[model samples]
Target: MQTKTRRSMIIIAIANGLLLFGYGLSLPFFTIYLISQRGLTSSMAGLVIALAGLSRCVSSGISGELADVFGRKTVMVWGLFSQIVAMFALGLCIELKVQVGWMLACYFLTTFLGAFFRPASNAWVTDNTTPKERVEAFGIIRIGLNIGWALGPAAGGFLVRYSYSMAFFFTALLYAVTILYLNRQVQDNHTPCKSRKPSFVSALLSLKDSRLAKICFYVVVITAVNSQLVVGLSIHCKQYLHMPEYYIGWFFTINGLVVVFLQYWATRLMAKIRLSTAMFIGCALYAVGFGSVGFFDGFTLIALGVFLAGLGELIVSPGEQTLVSNIASRETRGRYLGMLMVFYNLGSAAGFFGAGLLSDYVAPHYLPGPWLIVGAAALLAGWGFWRMRRSLTDEEDGKTNVPVPIKKDTITLN
Candidate 1:
């Protein structure tokens, strides 16, 4: 890419890494804190976590429209600042032994604000790059994100054991640094805001393009299938395969580290292919990897399952982001992306909730049922992408920028 773009990508990557690190540092022990220290029941803790998921879904589309109206850098700065405040507030609560209600408020605000800037940052990158460069740009950012994921949980584990307050405080400090660094270094693309258009209904209407709508549906399926990797996969490894808890932990380590190491290479490998084709291959890998888990009997095989799924993760993330960017006009990019995020958040919440239910109810009664269901979702998503491949011909022929007029509350793309 250009020197200017490279510099901007580096800054964006660093900012994303810092944000994920802060979030991850407090994640693993959150439920434990609620149940053990705060005296909440298991169901209450789940309810607390569900509130954050709900906030993300509700805020995503709104934030995307705000990004378009207020400008990407402005939304991003404010979003990061909000996260900083939420993190520090949570930390202070831990230090002061504050009530559960205060912790819930802090958590809700953090998740809500966190949803806002993602589409803005993503749109900022989309604003800055051509269709061809976006895949690599997104891949580099994904690598930076995974780097935080790989390291943060381990650090959080230590900190939670030592002092939960310390973990929250350190994470808050990271967010503060990220806010300062991003505000100083990142430049906005300055797409003119549509002053005449009302945002809420308009943002929802941006998905009127049939192609974009289908892609969003496919994302929901794919994300639902992938979400099994976190809760369902971990439980299956420990409960059925009889792996040690430490061994189960290593499965996630393998997944994250593999993506960190191979994401860019996978992006390069898929760069020359059509985006739909890459997505098909990715979804297929996910189907095969997770489906094979049904037959595996040992820790090594489970690790291999995670590895294949990790490869799929590396291939899918950048490909899908590039596709969404290609489909959107520069002016409505954030809104389109935000619409996509709404589907993603909903899918993730369903997937996690469904996976837990399946693991608890189905896995015990029917060993292969949950894996088969997840694999089926992936296959279904792959088929959807294959059917939608025709829509991507425009991007392939360099017609991705063909203007689509944004009417008062609707976008019509040719």
Candidate 2:
């Protein structure tokens, strides 16, 4: 990689680490905060989270076009700053002992802001690197993210009990620092926009490669499976497996450490494997990990399930991002990224809400019903990725120099 590109990657990774550390610090406790502090019921807390997911989905509706038109850095800066404001605002609610309604408003706004930068950051990575460097580049970024994920909660676990407001304040400060870092180190990497604004429908429907849509759909299914870790897995551990709350946190800690220490090496090893094959293996791992969770009572078995799921995440995360970049044209990369995230956001919502509903209504008597359903969905989706790969040309896989050009645009790294 060129020096400037390498520099940008480091800056991006650091910024992600800082922001996510702050985010992770407060996030795991948010449901507890709402229920304990605001006196909301369990169902209400889940509803709030589901609503935030919906807010993120709606806010992201046009973010891709905005990033493409205005610039990646411009959109990212706006998103980061707004998130700082939202976090502090939520903290104020906690400090003042405000109504649950107020807390929900702040929560929605915070996640809405997140919708912009999630895609923008990934688009920025695609802008800075070539097809060949993508997996390693994304791997580096994932480690940065997981570092924050690991450390933030460990620190937050201590700080939150002392002062919830203090934890939120620290998170806000981290976001402020990330804003400054991004403004100084990252540049607007998108090409100059066309004179006319493109409508979302036109932009999506205009895609020359139909294969991108199929891949994104698979992304939705897989991500839905992944989302269960946050919703169903925790409940399963506490309710059926008889794991304590403290140990639940340890499970996440273990998952984050595995990703942080192993992501780069894993990405490198899997780089030589076919993308579709890697995805098949990954999705199968997810199925086995999550499915086996329902059948086991042993503590070691539960931990094994968590570790296997993390391994699956390590395999798929970069592969999916690299695959998207390969399929998208320069002109439409941001839009494609945005579209993919819609599925991600919606899938998250589905996992949270769907798992809860299934547990309460469909499978209250059966311990493993929710797990098996999502696990089977993921297993089938893995097969779908393998099926899709059979139709891809050598050019799409970067095995040949033959380019799949749908639009003419100069790619610049600042």
Candidate 3:
């Protein structure tokens, strides 16, 4: 039984990994492609990315609620099917020589569809696993995520060098493969919630509960800091440091290799540390890593900074996700994860736009502006973690001193 379960998890991880890899392959290059091929300004490219993230903020929440009303598998299937269409649309955009505005519209639609999969995927794992198993399960998923991210860009860069259309074609093929893998290999029989659909506004309102609100806030801040890697770091490397385009893939590859080797061990180590402390330490590392960018010009030093940032990311991401999972009730798992994902998307969108504006006008020095912002964001997140550390500890101990569960229906505070 354990073997079968493990096999199922691995299959799901591969499907998820492929989907993410396809996205990562395109993400770093999308803006550059738009600027070169479509005559878009840097600000316009940033806006396009921000719009996709904005769509995710809306779509993830709705998908989370829908996953609760329908089954997780049902929602996941919908997401994957939509991804196929999105990839095809993207490819078509390239073929038709679509305008930049139209391309941005497609990108928004694609991301909106894609966002639905994440909450469903997260909730499905929680639905399947026991508490003791969840941390390790999440770690496995994270490994798959990193592996996909690591491979995607390197593959995409090589494909783009041959033909930009080939990049989209490859992405579409991966999406098709992902759909087939999920359809053939996976089985999810969890029942959907029978309750009436919850309003997104009401869900957002529920976050007013001090403890839950605080946790969400910290997640937002941390995600904002992390966004600099995707939006700012690549641009910084290319513009100021005169790094070659191909090296962007190598940077992520190095980070992915580190995470693949270290994440399992890190997950085990996290068993000994408080989740909040781990998050705090992770944010601090981000601060140091991003801050160090201002002082370093060598590719080696910059790569080292990225490696340290990845290390911090490895520590915080799984721990923070596990912490969120532990805090919510089973019935509301989708909604909680969805809400968390929204915060993540919002932070990322804000960071991208903010970084773009700063790099364009405020600090033509490009590298320093985004790095400083990321550092400041990390410090702010750390402070939020410290303030809530006591509450996190109390809640873990089953102490009543912590705030009550925001919803009356929640079974345990965790």
Using TM-score as the measure, name the better of candidate 1 and candidate 2.
2
Provide the TM-score for each candidate, comma-separated. Answer: 0.87, 0.90, 0.91
lDDT by residue (1-414, candidate 1, tens digit) is: 788887788789878888777766775466556755787654455456555766787788877888877888888888878877887888888888877778788878877877877888888888887776788899888887877766776567566766888888888788888888887888787765655443677666777788788988999889888767655665576556765444544565677787789987887777666677778899999998998887787878877887888888888877777777777776678888888888887676667667656766787788889898999899899889877777666554233444333224347321
Computed on alpha carbons, the lDDT of every model, listed in order, comes to 0.75, 0.76, 0.74
Report how far off residue 411 is in candidate 3 (Å): 12
Per-model clash counts, in order, read 0, 0, 0
lDDT of 3 by residue, 52-104 (tens): 88888998888778877788888888787887787778777876888866767
Which pairs of residues have clashing backbones in candidate 3?
none
Least accurate 10 contiguous residues by lDDT in model 3: 395-404
Supply candidate 3's per-residue lDDT for 283: 89
lDDT of 3: 0.74
TM-score of 3: 0.91
Question: What does candidate 2's lDDT look like per residue over 1-414, in tens digits?
Answer: 578777778788888888878887776667656655676654556667777877777666567777787888888898888888998998898788787678778878888887888788888898888876777788888888888877887777677777887888888889998898887887775775766474676545634456777887888788878877766666566555666545666666667787899997887776676778888888998898887777777778878988998888888888888777777778778877777777678777767667556655555687778778888988988998888777776555544444455544322211
